[model samples]
Target: SKFGTIYFWRVHYNDSSDHVNETFSFRPVQPGGGGGGMGGA
Candidate 1:
């Protein structure tokens, strides 16, 4: 990922009793610019 660039991700899970799915997004930050970038669910 590049600085200031937006990235997306998806998560999925399955079990005998349930199924789960989710989507998430976040932006990249510059190195040593602090912690991880902002994200949304």
Candidate 2:
């Protein structure tokens, strides 16, 4: 998770014809209540 920072990602797909058929994208995940805490320290 990130500290409320804007993140972007994308994935491209192509066929055997060497043509880009589609493009997929999304914003992975968000931080928790502790502002992005990890395993118990």
Clashing pairs in 1: none
Assess each prediction's global lDDT (C-alpha) against the native: 0.27, 0.26
Candidate 2 lDDT, 1-41, residue by residue in tens: 43322231112222323333321122232233132432221
Could you estimate the TM-score for every candidate? 0.13, 0.15
For model 1, the run of ten residues with the poorest summed lDDT: 19-28
lDDT of 2: 0.26
Looking at model 2, residue 21 earns an lDDT score of 34
The C-alpha stretches of model 2 lying farther than 4 A from their native spots are 3-5, 9-23, 27-41
Q: What's the CA RMSD for each of the models?
A: 8.9, 10.8
Show pairs that collide, candidate 2: none
- What does candidate 2 score on TM? 0.15
The CA lDDT at 27 in model 2 is 22
- Residue 18 local lDDT, model 2: 32
